[model samples]
Target: MSTHTPGEDVPVRRIDRILAFMSLGLLVLSIVCFFAIMIGSASGADMSGGVWPLIGVVVYIAPIVAFALMLAVLIMSFVRRARANRGG
Candidate 1:
């Protein structure tokens, strides 16, 4: 007989939620920046003032940051499940 309820769902940890959101947000930001750069280049728009530099950096950096955050989330989740299965 199973001790757990079939309909029960595990609650997400606060850190897990925050990490997931941050990772997703960064991924989206990187994609938008990438498209903006592509369109700007295709249209020969001046891309050297105001927020352009910041956007360029984001296009390169955001995906890396997001990947790292996602890796962290995965590791934490693995540890949590391991502990739970161990009856900790």
Candidate 2:
């Protein structure tokens, strides 16, 4: 026999929900910064006002992807919790 706790996988009761939300917010922040950096890069050259390829790209790519992942998991947890609560 297997035993389980109530709201074990539930988003409302899980810490991941908070983490996911935080991740999403941070990702959004990164995105905003990314555009700014990219525009700044576009304007000039490295030695003469160019964008830093490594830093700018990382700024854009990492947060967006991370936030998506976090949001996905958070949603899943919430749905799972709702389903369990409903005895579905």
**Best-fitting candidate, scored by TM-score:** 1
Query: Model 2: what TM-score?
Result: 0.46
Candidate 2 has its poorest 10 consecutive residues by lDDT at 45-54
* Candidate 1 lDDT: 0.88
Name model 1 segments beyond 4 Å from true: 1-9
Quote the RMSD, in angstroms, for model 2. 6.6
Distance (Å) between predicted and true CA of 51, model 1? 1.7
Give the C-alpha miss distance for residue 84 in model 1, angstroms. 0.6
TM-score (all chains, Cα) for each model: 0.83, 0.46
Question: In candidate 2, what are the lDDT values of residues 1-88, reduced to their tens digit?
Answer: 4476673644354566667676777777677767777677688646234445655666767786776778777687767777787778
Best by lDDT: 1
- The CA lDDT at 75 in model 2 is 81
Write the residue-wise lDDT of candidate 1 on 35-85 in tens digits. 999998899888988788999999989999999999999999887776666
Each model's number of backbone clashes?
A: 0, 5
